[model samples]
Target chain A: MTKNLSNVNQIIAKYQGDQSALIQMLLEIQRENRWLPKPVLARLSQKLGIPISQIYHIATFYKAFSLIPQGRHTVSVCLGTACHVRGAPRLLDRVTDTLKLNPGETSVDYKFTLKTVNCLGCCALGPVMVVDGEYYGKPSAKEIEKVIANCD
Target chain B: MKKLQKVTLTINDREVTAKEGMTILEAARDAGIYIPTLCYHEKLAPYGACRICTVELSRNGRSRLVTSCVYTVENGLIVKTESPKVIKVRKLLLELMLASSPAKAIQDLARQYGIEKRRFEADKTNCILCGLCVRYCSEIKQANAIGFVGRGTERRVVFHPEIASTVCASCRECFSLCPTGKLPSETDGVCFDDLTLDDFLKTQQSPA
Candidate 1:
């Protein structure tokens, strides 16, 4: 809803018309807005003079970027080797059941977005999850229910 | 050589200057401030996989938490590397990382932090906390030798569907880089040339 292109324009200006900063600038904008809309990408394309296809390509290339809407809370489950052997699949099942949505999907109320990551580099805590960038380790299906309840 | 632009930033109340495009970790180290980090080596680009180097930065009246390894230095930036909030967050992040990785090194670090047993249930997975396997396979190796499959709790790193040696070199690069000994040897001739998904899974069950 930040329709006033002032901030976005300001960001563009700060980069000194460098199109290379496109991805970085987009990341900053998305961080503030939560999700990138088509209009914003088009605006970026117009300002940077880059093709919308190229912009979309770069956006899709990075796992961090998302074209669809994301929830207020982002839940990232680590699916590294350690977590996998430790029954991470079961944990994921629990999360899906509780949230009533699979990975890469958002909850019905738009409160949570569930994602699975390869590794968070915190293998010490197998079966790890990051809720809104806050790490939660060694969670059980039952424990996940409590965690989700606490989030509410 | 063209001199890189240098920028001054404050980290944990200490003023430090570093070359433009340098990560917050490099800047903090140049300023003699120690910020614990894993999965970050001076020889490599910042991967931002490990959440241990999370720091709070304030620039132009706006503050945010970011991984110092991936965050670049900006002029007139204010950073807090160590504080109660940061410590708490770091502790939790480390704890979470530990739960997934049951490597001895990870456990040793946990002990240093006074965490004897994990607060959360043990994941009992074979993924060691070290990110070498993932990093080498994805970034340096460019083989995508393995990748995370599934989502949410079911997420895991595995050879692509119909795992074939054509997709993987079986060069043992991942095995060497793995901090844990989870990667099995490829001496079995099956992975030497090309392997099918069934062959790979069967290999995992029976080692070379």
Candidate 2:
């Protein structure tokens, strides 16, 4: 947690101490840290002199920022038309069963966060799952278990 | 008049110089190094949402990933706009963005990169974080009626409180800007083909 704060401070410093760059800076910070915590928001508010309420508002308003701690691995399922017609729902169910978590929920051990997306644009490979920045296409229920095992 | 400061930098191992305030993207373009980007136009300020223009820069012997669109050229900056790491990150970013918004435009680009399947399952939700509609309605059209509501994973553009009416003019400015044609309409509720809300908003504006 302290490390996250220090990282936020570094980001704040990169913006030349400007609060207006809050959104972009926070985006970058989140990219590095995976998620933003409330304490970090307070620190940003104090550093930038912006009200904590305003920071909270902006944080809540943007779809990019997350208030909770994210899992170590994030699995995003693509449900584009091609994927949908190709049994993406079945794949989603398999993933949820394998991970034991619902969509948008993280595993109890924080090993994985399961999420579903509209489309990955790779229709040729329906039922795509992107895990920890790695792409996996046309994965079956069994294949997903192998992939998760490989991650471990 | 304030004197414009010049900064010398290296892009793709080639030496080039640019104005201090110039973005690394501008300097690279001037130097003939092409960096792929979306949501970045010369006429508008950099949005940095695409994350495709990320470059690996080594400054003071430390390296970091910086978006070329927003990063300014600095003296002694050694930048590699295209590297193995940079390519990987760009591809991942593209994959993530594509997953969020399943559109023909995104698919075409993904095909170019040989991304056959996203590693994750598909999300049924249609909203992508492109912010094009938000920008058009708020910035270009100056309507500011519909804006992004919700945060992180649940973020979406809707009339406040998910109600039908608030500030939305229903000019369909957002509909046109939407890449997937998934904007909400009154006719069929959430169906893509329904445009009753759009028509109603138009009627409200003209009010014959």
Candidate 3:
């Protein structure tokens, strides 16, 4: 319990515990821990004077937050108009086959999370597969497999 | 002497007056203006979930659609309960309601607006997330056993996994208010108590 308190306090101090910074604090915690633990969220609610239900509402309202465990790599395939016309669905299938995950699901090994995004605003890079910060444009099966092997 | 404050506004090009702190819906109803709504109840607090009571407000020429159930009255607020834009928003919302539940209540409401078919595929989850049941449980019964869980397309009204059993046995106020409720028979909470992740998956597997 003391360890949890100190960990939460360290995070709270990093942003000076601003009320408006709750979302950002949750995001940073998600990045570090790969998910928002219930205990961590409770600590945040207590420290921020926010109701746990409200915090849960906010966390669930946004697509960015995840309460359950997440994989190390966030892999997203664009299925927007441009990507669709350029064969984004097939590319998504190939990536999913390589990682053994379906859309809106993470791999059992916790290495990669496979998801489908509407658009990434980079239509020029049609058929885009974003593995975290790295964007792969028009990637073929061989390229996706290589990317999968490279994933930690 | 404490006197009630009064406010006047123009709704649908007709001058209407109402007391201050009254919602636009109440004022419009008093003025005999017909505004469609689904998630509103007189006994409970205003819930803008259904978005069917949206109206166009043109205050100072900045027109925007606002839900009448929650938007309060202010003097000089130009309200259009059946403006073209307002109708369009209501039509979209009704189609969504149709998608959620095709019960007689939903169908009867849609038929009033000449809506016979749904433009989009019916999700068929049957529960529209109106929060009527949740609100009734909390406010009237003081039982917080049910609430909104998850997010986005994965969102749904659900009994809290741990608390739905003991507290919800005798409470059926929400059931009466639910547009598509079919649970809580004489056994009471027997169905909701067995809600597992598998049940959630089964609902998700249904064509949405």
Give the better candidate number (1 or 2) by TM-score. Answer: 2
* Model 2 lDDT tens row, B17-73: 899799999998888888887666665567787788899999777899999999988
TM-score of chain A of 1: 0.90
> Per-residue error at A55 for model 2, in Å?
12
Best by TM-score: 3
lDDT of 1 by residue, B34-153 (tens): 888767766556778767888888766777788888888899888898766677777787688677776665666566666654687667555534456545655676655455422344
Model 1 chain B lDDT-worst window of ten: B199-208
Which portions of model 2 show Cα errors greater than 4 Å? A1-152, B159-208
What is candidate 2's TM-score against the reference?
0.48
lDDT of 2 by residue, A12-88 (tens): 88998797799998898778877777778778877897654456457656645666667888888887788888888
Estimate, for each residue in A1-152, the C-alpha lDDT of model 1 and write its tens digit.
46636668887888986999998888877776666676787778788987554565466556676666778888888888999987777777888788877777776687988888898888888788888788878887778888888886
Query: CAPRI verdict on model 3?
Result: incorrect
Tens-digit lDDT string for candidate 3 (A1-152): 46655777888899898989989988887777777777888789788876554566677666677766779999989999999999997898798788877776766778777778888999998899999879999987888888878877
lDDT for each of the candidates? 0.68, 0.71, 0.77
What C-alpha lDDT, on a 0 to 100 scale, does residue B28 get in candidate 3? 93
Query: Judged by TM-score relative to the true structure, which candidate is superior, 1 or 3?
Result: 3
**Candidate 1 DockQ category?**
incorrect
In model 1, what lDDT does residue B39 have?
71
